[model samples]
Target chain A: MSYRKAYLAAPLAALLPVQAAAQGIDETINTIFADYTGWYVSLIFADLPGTNFSWIALWLVVAALVFTFYFGAIQLRGFTHSIALVKGDYSDPDDAGEVSHFQALATALSGTVGLGNIAGVAVAVGIGGPGATFWMIVAGLFGMATKFTECTLGVKYRNEYPDGRVSGGPMYYMTKGFSERGLPGGKIFAILFCIFTILGALGGGNMFQANQAHAQLSGVLGEYPGWITGLLLAGVTFIVIVGGIKSIAQVTEKVVPFMGIFYVIVSVIILLMNFDMIGWAFGQIFMGAFTGLGVLGGFTGALIQGFRRAAFSNEAGIGSAAIAHSAVRTKEPVTEGYVALLEPFIDTVVICTMTALVIVITGVLNIDPETGLYVWNSEAGRISTEGEVAGVELTSAAYARAFSWFPAMLAIAVVLFAFSTMISWSYYGLKAWTYLLGEGAAKETTFKVIFCLFIIIGASANLGPVIDFSDAMLFSMAVVNVIALYFLMPIVKRELESYVSRLRSGEIKRFKS
Target chain B: MSSEVFVVAYEGAQDDPGVLGYAMQRAAVEGATLLLVHVLEWSPYSFLTPEELEERHGRRAKEIERARSDVTGPALDKVKAAGIEAECVIRYGNVVELVVEEAGKAGAGMIFVGRSGSQSVAARVFGSVPMGLAQISPVPLVIVP
Candidate 1:
């Protein structure tokens, strides 16, 4: 991702001195990126032969399935226990005013629940049809196990400093867990993970969010230049991270989660309003999953898009949630695992499903009356829809069907989601940067400066391949993270077994009703 | 055990020493014991990051230490000098509820609380602990100026 961006950015940087002489900067940048990274993008997002499933998406789904079985379907068995943990039922009240399982989950959800559910889901249904929703739900269910496994290990092998700050993620776990198992290459694996994490944080977390947010703002507020938005985001980020305006930061943290709840509530309202079509929408999703109906790629198209979107949406196997969940104040690490598993369920199974149902029930997808399938818009390579729309716009249009003002609401949601994701990623990236450079005032400040710079570029520059490359970096993180998980999952199993047994015996006391 | 007991709703703010002084004198005169109750204003619904969550144990430990060193410990010494038996409690929750509960548990004859002096609009709008305790106190309430 970094290489591709620099390769594309160098000439653009040179053109800065002569922008009037060399016009069409946006088109030029897009063309250069598309040409240079086409092969790499294909390799990253390549389909598996006759099937539509990308290998990266397959890797995530397979890992989720493996964990579901390996942990004896911990997601399902521990679901209620996870809810209890989030609710602080078993938490000691003496330790109140700290991060609860719910807070960690909320923070992590803010990271994943951004544009993926809004824009990414629309892209899926546009191509894969409503049947893709079924696959997305399935993938999400399995993904819960992956979250449980990673977060259990996250808390178990975290670094607790003298100052009471804790740091945990694939980097900590890969190094610590691997070393605990007498492995020699833990440090190298950890270093690789950190590198990927930083890059992923910059591209997907920072730049992509800014870019998408700009796109949304422009969609609503007219064809305003992107830098204005970029400057605004950069300024806010600078104030919070650099200026040390904690009150504003606190308001932001609160805003992100409240917006998330608000989005879900609105989706619920739309669903209830379309009450009669709910069951019929499910029928379409189920039938489309197998038959593909008017959708392209038959059953495989729907499954691939669903799996891809779910992987992107909830981010279970990516190991980012582990960082957030690791801070949970529980003696039993398994409690955090239970709490973490709820993330995928909420992000994918609930939020994404709500978005999909609203899209389907509203009859946004163009359907062939004869075939009773989603009308295939082969040029767009997904299911055809009214106006041939895709991405966040399609989701906006669908919601607008229920309420005319919804697109405007969605635009606000898009910007908020994008901004919140950027902020969370800033933290994630900062941690990775610190891990690589060693924690210090200077190193941290330097990383923050670069992060701010990228937010600007992401908002202003139309570098399609660069963002795509960053997304590749994100998927690459899952690759390294899951490899480390394979080595470390046994330890998680041991923790889960012990916690579950003790709970069954009433050893873990519940202090709250 | 003393026949009479007095509870001081001590937040240990600027006027807390005055409140404690008033309560200590009253207790000594009536041959009553003292309960120096300090509530470390906290809510379960407050937002906390993961780092804050991990440090909750240490933070709670510090809250208790601070309560002892800053408020209850000094007040306890003052009461001892006055020849009145006194105990301390540092708890977490609503100030009014915790203060009243501690007073009731100790079987106190009266509760002493500090006034906010100005009775500013901000305090009235947001609601003050002293006002809350006055409304809810089970026993006779004394507002220390």
Candidate 2:
């Protein structure tokens, strides 16, 4: 308890300096982040030779395409069975000696379904136009195969300690899966993956979430210093992560699923309210996706933005979900893979699509009436909008059109989503940290403290450099993880083949309807 | 061999256990066996945090162990002390369904359920275990007040 007081005091103590410098601190931090991380961010997101497309975006999309083919389009073929598995129809109590994966899937969904669905889609549709939504669904569909492959490897190579604890992710699979295949550089790959995972957890997973939460709040509560929100969020986050408070974390986890459902319901109601405009929206999406409809970079621009945001949104090839899904209780690793594939579908295909549709239907993006093209704001480098808003602000504005009170509700949702994402990523970062440094209480506490501190940094900093750096780190993980997936995919194929055969042959029994 | 096995829906130590007493008397009279069934209410679809999901396996094992020791184990000793053949089954799921399934599997001649007579809204709306068993039990259901 004394240590708890010390931990609580640490953030408050640090806040004084932050508040003292709050005037120019935002610009200072943003500039510093950009200066330090800009080279790597530029390199990772560098456009392909002779193209405006990011090679990393292509990296993820290509890997997903390969997985989609290599698994014989398993995302589509296994769709019905994945639903059944999630519904607990295939779970046998005798076989489920441990907890089932339904809850694991739900937890993973909460982690991915947050700001990505809300804000990321807005960015995509705002820049890429409605057509970005179409490619987003396509990417999401293909990304399911990537999730299936990685999560299967996640479960197969996972380390089970004697204390009934388990740990797994791309790092484990890279080392073990590669060693078994006599591949060189397996350890190097594992180390690289761990490094990227830690940074990604801090950047995309922690800071990006906090930054957006602050922005959403500022939009609603009038202008305020970002550090004020940052300190408050960091303090509460410290209590939950460092203080070992399960009740608060549990309450957030419970509410997140309902929030996801409520978001979908609200989006559906808004869509129904403009039911007549539905066909026109899809037409815009279809046209914008192919022709880009005079939008910047034309067809390629829409494709790149759609693919980039979808990769960010669903996290198909990113491999973070693999770490979460690996902890599921299952003897058959393929079952968890089946359960994992549903994540991208739910996050990108279903929820992200809902957001994209609402944004389009709400008339947030300014359209040239005669040309029927999204008005490209040359200065802003995205579509000209009603308030020149982008990201989560654009989303809040769109939803506010339908319901005057929606912005306030969206603010709360943003905060909750940000908190949940931070908590989830703290675990992810801890896992990667321990993977690199080995596990211990002192080591874990250090990571947790650093993680809480970054929440303040993320909250206080401007979005430009923080998002760029985070996206770069996250994509770097995919660069390592997808390479491992290529080598280890055969093992997943074997597992999937055996399971599907047994399933069809009736050797695998279903316990309930 | 006495084929009669009376399924006692053991409601843990919280209830009166008058149903267990009634089942014990009936089993003794018929020289029958008492099958104690304790179903811990659980759902696989319940939401959990990542830490909770990670440690769920360990927690579930502890829960089953606690239920056996704190609830079923004492009831089994009570039934054995009464000089009647008995066995106990513990599982995690919907109480009524698992109890009925266990009863049918054990070739139960009757099911003895304790009615706490709870007026709680949840019980009234969702129906208590006794009410559920009364509807779905394959064997004769006796609600002991």
Please tell me which predicted candidate would have the highest TM-score against the true structure.
Answer: 2
Model 1 TM-score relative to the real fold: 0.89
Supply the global lDDT for candidate 1. Answer: 0.80
Cα error of candidate 1 at position A104, Å: 1.8
lDDT of 1 by residue, A1-513 (tens): 245435534544553555453335445645765686577768888888886678988898889889989998988878888888888899886665556777778878878898889887887788788889999999999999999888888888888877667788888988889989998888888888888888788878887778778776666554455665777888988887777665665676678777778888989999999899999999988998998777767888888888877887888888788887787777888888898899889999999999999999888888778867667766756677777767787888888898877776787788878777777777888778888899898888888888888787677666356556666878878989998998998898888888878888999889877
Q: B1-145, model 1: which lDDT tens digit per residue? A: 5568888888775655688888877887898888888888876566654345556657777778888998778878878887889888888878899889888888888998888675789877877877888788999999888
Cα lDDT tens digits, model 2, A1-513, are 245435544555555655557848877777787788899999998998898888888888889999999999999989888899888888878534465778779988878889989988988888888889999999999999999999999999988877677788888998999998898888999889889989998998999999999989878765566877888898998999999987888999989888889999999999999999999999989999999976798888889889988888778878889888888877789999999999999999999999999999999999899988889999988999999999999999999999988987898899999899888889888888998999899999999999988888888888777778878988999998999999999999999999989988999988777
Which candidate number has the best DockQ? Answer: 2
**CA shift at B71, candidate 1, in angstroms?**
4.1
- The deviation in Å at residue A191 for candidate 2 is 1.5
lDDT at A176 for candidate 2? 94
lDDT of each: 0.80, 0.87
TM-score of each: 0.89, 0.95
